[model samples]
Every structure is written in structure tokens, then in C-alpha cells.
Target: MNHEHKISNWDLIKNGLFGENTIFRMAISLCPAIAVTTSLKNGFLMGAAVLFVQTMVNITVSLLRNFINPRIRIPVFMLIISGWVSVTDMTMAAFAREAYRQMGLYIQLIVAFASILARAEMFANKNKVVPSMFDGIGMGLGFMFALVVISFFRELLGRGTIWGYEIVATKPLLIMLLPTGGFFAVGILMAFFNWIDIRFYGGKGAGGAGGH
Candidate 1:
């Protein structure tokens, strides 16, 4: 692994949360973002699962970076990711059985999330432990935040509910609960954030180096 740029821990966190947000900014992991985000409860649990796995994988990879051969780093990263994803899967299955029933496979699928591997390779492997941890937190939080936002709107507008609790007598937009609406939600949110990035932040999309 190659050492990348050095920045304050806070900056790394902000970068993961905003500059390189996995869904809204970096545009990664849209499968879960769409499939599991039809409801707020689903979205939150899925995001939580990813957050744990992503953070742990980053820490593990950073710890073993020097020991891993560059030629085999990808396989090593996958192994590390699968190990953590399994932990997340079983933990959720044990404690959050109902939600786990709905998203169990997706939880297992976290092992394949490109964002996790990207972070391990591009940021964590090249950074120190504390910084890598913060980076993981940032990225995980950003991903969770994006899912929460999308699912909030999706659940609210589509089902007239929040986290499965009814808030209205009638459904607002049924389509929002469907895959087409998932694309609509992701696209709209992505553009909205992109506009914010350009209008206020002078715009730098989360590039390959910025995302994980």
C-alpha cells in the first residue's frame, strides 16, 4: 500500500461524510441504497450494518497493510471485509431478527460493497490506525446518512409512514416505494448534493482517492 496525503482526522471524517459520501457523493453502493431503502426501518438497519462492517474492515486492513503483499491485497481485503460482514450479519440476526429477516441477504452482501474495499485500499491501507478509524467512521456515517435521507423521503412520500409508523391516512406517492422511484430518489439527491458542492464548496467531486 502506498502512503497517501496527510490531513487532520477531522478533515478525513468530513471527507467521508460529505466530500466522498458513498451514495450521494461518490455514487457507490446504490444497490442497497435502492433495494433496502424502500422503508426507513430497512434503510436504517442496512446502513447500520454497513457502518459497522466498513469501520471494522478499515481498521483491520490498516493494521495489516504492511504485512499484506501488494499482489494479494485485493483478496486480503475481501477476506477482511467478509470476516467483518459475517460478524455484522450474525449480530443483526441474533438481536434484530425481524429486520434481519428482511435484509439478511443484503447484510451478507456487504462483503462485496465496493465502498468498503475502496476505502481499505485507497485510504485505510495507506493511513495510520487512528486516522483510518476516523476515515471509516466518516465513510460509514456518510453512507448511513445518505440512506437515512433517501429512505426518509421514500417512506414518507410513498407510504405516508416513517419507520413503518403511519403518519398519514393516505399514501402520498406509491411509486416512491418501487425501484423506479429508488433511481429517482438517488438521482435527485445526487444532483442536489452536487449542486451544493458546486455552489457553496467550489466543487470537487469525491474522486477515486477521496472515495473508498
Candidate 2:
């Protein structure tokens, strides 16, 4: 049986949402997770941008897969990824200027995102266009989901605020806004999710994840 035929689109999406989330499970693309996730808004916007780029890249690559020569696939993939990232970069710059100013470079850096390129090479290149698109959506959503969770805690705990609205009138935990705090937050969350996987999902940490 063909893999694509056996797998439903929703299963493909669910796989990315929980089974093999890029940041939480695959552990790739931590730079943005740490660098841009100090605030919920930044994190969510970053995730949204990546989601769009990843989806477009996957669909484009899958559509062009047969035409791409095997020997030149890597460079071709980079070109595709970069093209989509540039589109995303320009769109964000035009619509969300302040956010673009804050994490603009990071958005450009999405051209080099492992999750996007990895999906292009691993799943998208081998799959049909619709399946590849869903895979991209799932993985992108997973990445966004991870960033949202990470940023939510970092902002709430560090700034005593959510989305720039002050909730607590006390001194915030300054460390949570720093890179050190990012690591701590990711570790604790990773461990918590790992516990959930082991206890109920019967997962073996990252090894049994759905990315592969």
C-alpha cells in the first residue's frame, strides 16, 4: 500500500500538532523559539510567518519535485525556501512594521529553517501535493503551537503581562525574558510533555515522534 494513500490528511496534521512538533519534539529551530519568544505577540507572529512560508514551500516543492534533478535538489530546495521566506518577509514588513522591526532578521532567517527544509527533503519531495501541503500545515502549526506556549509563559512570568496588558502589579521575573529563561522554560515544558507522552501516549520521547 502507498503511504500517501494509507494516511489521511487529518492524521498528517495531527502528527505535526502533537506527535512530532518541530520545536517540542524534533528540537529543531530553537533559535527563534528562544530569540523571538520573549513576548506572546512576537512569538505568535513569528510562528504565523513560518507557518505560511512552510506551507507554501512544501506545496511548491512537491509540485516541482519530479522536475527537480536529484543532484541539484538541495540548492533548488534552498531557492524555494528562500523565495517563500522573502514573500513572507515582505508581507510582514508591510503589514506589521513594528513586529518586522523587532524580529525581521529572524524572519529572513526562516529561509534556513530546518523544519521547512527537512520537510521538503523528507516528506514533501516524496509525497503528493495535497499530502505534502497537509504535512506542511501540521508541522507549521506544531511549530507555532510550541512558540505560543513558550512565549505565553515567558511573557506572563517575566513581564507579568500578556499581549502587553499588565496582569500582575508586582516585580516581574526578569530572567524569564532572557535567553537563560527561554532554555529553562523549554526544558520544563519539554519534560512535562515527555511525561505526558510516556504516561498516556506510550511514546518514547523524540525517537517515536512522527517527523520521520
Candidate 3:
């Protein structure tokens, strides 16, 4: 009776992985997806951090949904998410000191990313705990896919390497690793996705405009 709609776990995974890819589809978490993806390692690290934070927060929020007052849900969600991020920060500092140093403020900045909050408000708030967990994984994967691709390009042409493993022996573009390069990479990728959506997926699109 509870799962009357009968949404299977596999169905959920498919939804997140492809049907609702965070970048080319859902388009929910773009800020970090674009800003932090300077290298393959950075992109992967950021994505893993987001996955952990999102999954934990989603489950926690879903369990507390009934207790959380609607009037203060946003603030409550922010506090809970921040708690997980703090924990993650400390864990990273303990084991991966170098990554923790490299990540710096961005690691903590995950607290403010709208995507996590969006999950709490939209999916986790109403869904059961298990579904909420799946939602988080799906959304995080979508976000990761977007970030990895962008970082892949940025690290390659911008630096002539993939995640610091040198593929090209040249001096590289240099500019691709800069802030301006992030903008260029994201803009070009955005255009490419939009074109694909229009040409193939009908452009109904996800998220705000620009076809996500």
C-alpha cells in the first residue's frame, strides 16, 4: 500500500542517472559544477564530497520531515546540511590533509549550494527515507557527470593533462585552467547540451531556461 505507485529502486537509479542528469537535464547544481572543476582530481573530489553530504542529509531530513516546522524548514535544512559538511571537512582534514588544504573554503561552501537545499525541499521533504536516499544519489551523480566533463576539458586543453596525468607534452592553453576558462568551458558545454536537447530530446528541458 505504501508504494502504490510502485516505483522500483532501479527505476529511481535510471531517473537520476539519465532521465534527470543534473547538468544536461535537471540543471540544478551548476555553480560548483562549473567553478570547482579545474582538474579531474578536483572535480572527482568535489563530486564525492557532494555525494556523501547529499545522501546523508537527504536521509536525515526525510526522517525529520514530520518534526520540522514548515515555517523554519529552510533554516532547519541548512543547519543540518552544514552539520554534515562540517563533519566531512573534519574527516577530509584528518585523512586527506592535502586535499583538504586544496579544497579550502569550497569544501565548506557546499553548505550554501542550492542543490542540496533543493533536494531537502523538493524530494527529501516528502519522500520516504529510502526514496530520499536514492534521490540524493541520483542528483549527486547528475551533478558529478556535469562537473567531471567540464573539468576533463578544462584540465586537458587548459593544462594538457587529464587529472594531472599528462597526455600532451605541449605548453597547453594555460587559459583553460583560469576562471575565464571555467566560464568558457561551461558556456560551450551549455550550448552543446541545449543543441542536443532541441535536436533530440525535444527541448522541454529541465531546470531554468537554456535547456539546463
| The best candidate in terms of lDDT | 2
What lDDT is reached at residue 201 by model 1? Answer: 71
Give a tens-digit lDDT track for model 3, residues 1-212. 25612777667666666666766665556777767888888898888888889889999999999999999999999999999999988888898787778885788999998888888898889888998898888877767777888899998988788878889998488888788888788778877876776679776544434322
What shift in Å separates residue 131 of candidate 3 from its native position after superposition? 1.0
Provide the global lDDT of candidate 2 against the true structure: 0.91
TM-score of each: 0.93, 0.96, 0.87
Candidate 2 local lDDT, residue 193: 87
Candidate 3 global TM-score: 0.87
Candidate 1 lDDT for residue 40: 95
Encode model 1's per-residue lDDT on 1-212: one tens digit a residue.
Answer: 34434577898788888878889877888999999999999998888888888889889998999999999999999999999988888899899999999889899989889899999998888888888998899899999999999999999999999987899979989999999999999999888887777688777544433433
User: How do the residues 104-175 of candidate 2 rate in per-residue lDDT, one tens digit apiece?
Assistant: 999999988888999999988999999999999999999999999999999999999999999897647989
Candidate 1 whole-model C-alpha lDDT, 0 to 1? 0.87
Evaluation by lDDT, superior candidate among 2 and 3: 2
* Candidate 1 error regions (>4 Å): 1-5, 204-212
In model 2, which residue pairs have backbone atoms overlapping below 3 Å? none
Candidates' C-alpha lDDT: 0.87, 0.91, 0.80
Q: Which ten residues in a row have the lowest lDDT in candidate 1?
A: 203-212
